[model samples]
Target: MNGWSNHLIVAPILVPLVACAILLVIDERRRVAKAMVSLASTIVLTAIAIILFAIESGPSGFEGVYLVGNWAAPFGIVLVLDGLSAMMLLLTALLAVASLVFSFARWHAVGAHFHSMFQVLLMGVNGAFLTGDLFNLFVFFEVMLAASYGLLLHGSGQLRVKAGLHYIAVNLVAALLFLIGVSLIYGTAGTLNMADLAARIPEMEPDRRMLMEAGAGILGVVFLIKAGMWPLCFWLPTAYSAASAPVAGIFAIMSKLGIYVILRLTMLLFVEGPSAGFGAQVLFYGGMATLIFGIIGVLASQALGRVAGYSVLVSSGTLLMVIGINDGAVSSGALLYLVSSTLTISAFFLLIELVERGQDAGANVLAVTMEAYGDAADEEVPEEQGVTMPGTMAVLGICFAACGILLSGLPPLSGFIAKFAMLSAMMGTGAIGVPPTAAIWSLIVLVILSGIAALISMTRAGIRTFWSSIEGTVPRVLVIEILPVMFLLGLTLALTVQAGPAMQYMDATIRTLSKPSLYIDAVRTAAPTGGDVKSSSSEVESN
Candidate 1:
């Protein structure tokens, strides 16, 4: 049992891959089989994540690295199960399961292979989370990207195809840059393993140091592109809006992939000293810009889908800002925000799809009702085919309110907890320097402004759609369609109840990340060579 527990680190990664493989072989017409595969895999993955979290909660503080084939670091593959990875794995599992549940009825609406592609995408995301090698990160990233390519255009309409092209072009460039950066790092350090590279980084020659920094900087840009940071996020709203509802819901979580890697690499490998790196300033500025753009875009857009897409851009910006701030409190806050915002946004997206569909089916029913009531006097009656039910409108209203409040960091919500944590971190008694102070303040203002914009737009839309007089009978919302939204609401409430423990866990995770020597030592000791890598181990000490 102990041996099995120690090997649990690989399960999160393997479960999804195995599920994907099984899904690929299943008959697409066998919807039951596909749903079972997805649900069972997600449940098992979530269970494993919870178990790992409990195991890491013990006095040791981390589960340590799980080396594949007993190969030591700097040579063999490894998967590190630290606090960050465990938390992320758990969050991803939760969201994935929620998404799968939402898709129970809607999967066929999208297509036959939708579930298969979804599982493949999950495989990529989970693999990325568990990988301890930088090169493997690239492989997982590409895996996710390829699956996304299929999912994004699953419906294959003109708009989707066009939007997907833009998404593909941008990500391809980012992937190339990522590969180039990794090659440079490997060429200079003579190793591709994260732990070993961190140990060797401080001892590199001056020129080599500059080369690696350049590579890291380029790599940072690649992640920023993935994270939808300013100037690079132009394609996000369009592509996401054009995707099928379920695919869009899943993609909302996908944007976090870049930020996750940035957080991991920045703290674990790049935190040598102030003079040793460019700091997180670039990320901060980019995030702030992206936030502003997203707010403006949200306000400018009328369609619910596009509005939600822009909101995602804004959330991504805030997340990157927190990462760039690089304080333990800030990072913890970001993690909290990341998990909450993703759920809220995903729920919102799912709700939008339901509303859109229901509206289409209820338009005529609503038009007739409006004619009978004679309330159509001043209003432009919606096309009979486009009207939606009151119940569907109510659910949409609730989801929008939740998403807006949570995304904007309002009090008594998960988003607020995350924001407050970040604000506390940013105000940390001069730790971030004067420049950072200005940046932090700017971010705070941006967050408030964006929230206000979102509130106004969403409220206006909700009032017009839900409260205003309509001519037709409301459409019925399927239980499966509403289940995911309710689950997300419960999650948001749970976050509030468990805020204390959640924050503590995030803090501990950040602290563990801030001190990588403990991680390096663990890997060294656990290596098959049994701490034989003296130079690498000692180099970390000097740093």
Candidate 2:
């Protein structure tokens, strides 16, 4: 991390922050100007994320650390970039670009300061991914959540406001839990820096270690709620379903943010200490329950938006379960699944609004009634005839179908490839001669069943939205609105086509995560220039 690249480490956060300030000062009526600024800022963030990702991808993987105010870790603010954070940065940027572009159609104008809030949200997400300390992580989390509160209610409809209020109330409690957990951990470990905390955990006394674990468990609860774990996620479907299309699309990554933190902390804090294997069973069982719940929600959903919302739970549950597995080989596949499912779900959310556009409000109810009662049994059944689909309807239908295939883990898509990778990793090579455990078998069964459920639900929804409503008016969709969906879906296809390289990247990430020492060493040894850098916490203690 030298030269301009050192600055690149902070660009993702700064660009958005600056863009947000600029967007704020601009007249509200200049929507086009604001849109350009926001879009440009996001594009720059995307490019920076790409550069950082490429840096980490080098022959000798590099962890770029930007020491704020030229201060060392555990004493000063630091931003650390590794494979995991860099990958998350890229994912967030990509989703931001797609969602922002889609919003230009109309959603951006539905609310004042939409672009500013959008920038703030990006800044917070990027900062959360880049920050090297738990304290800053909390700061970024609040920033992200605050922006989400406004974004959730961006359109300001009755349903949006109601869902937004619930979303806010739930996350506020999570934030309070965050503060309590951080306080407990800091009191026990005497450090808020993640690397410092990891270093100190192993050396703590039994009682102190127990206290730390309790704090960690509480912290895990916060993330599990964000990850939409069962029982805690009752608000997810309603809130997400109520949000506007682009807001919902960008929100697809918000759940993954929780997963990212859980992955980061689980790898960095609990891997080597006395706390090893902490919260594994909770995540395992919790994830399974969440998956089952999501399956039920999907099956029971009548509206496309609600179905998309439940599908988010399905994605989150899979990731949580995979992380709980704690195998590097399995995590590699989980990473792939994370990216693939996110792209698919974001596309699905965007497509849902378009697919349901101009649809009769009672279409779903009528479809259900028709299915149950056989249409009066004798009301002169009309012979089926081929209908020429409009170009827009055809495109929406194709996108909807693509979403279904991806969500259901059907063949020839990244979703199937990801699930296959995990299953294969668990099964292992025949030469190993070790069979998977009953738990693994259970996971396999649940995963397969979830996919089947998604397929059935998606098919049913597709029939109601596309086929049964064939006589309905075609939606007036703009080229811009449809392109974002197409772009996101195309990425999933690219992931499928380039599964080899994508999995290679994920494998490297898993390798890095499996070894906590690598991350600890990188952060602890990072040096700053331009002034006298303070020694790390360990050096100060030694002195």
lDDT by residue for model 1 over 341-383, one digit each (tens)? 8888888888777666535435534654665797677667555
lDDT of 1: 0.78
lDDT of model 2 at residue 259?
98
lDDT of 1 at 504: 86
- Candidate 1, residue 139: CA error in Å? 0.8
Instruction: Judge candidate 1 at residue 411 and give its lDDT.
Output: 83
lDDT of 2 by residue, 93-123 (tens): 9999999999999999988999999999998
What TM-score does structure 2 among the candidates reach? Answer: 0.97
**Candidate 2 regions off by >4 Å?**
381-386, 429-431, 531-534, 539-543
Top model number, lDDT: 2
RMSD (CA, Å), candidate 2 to true, equals: 1.6
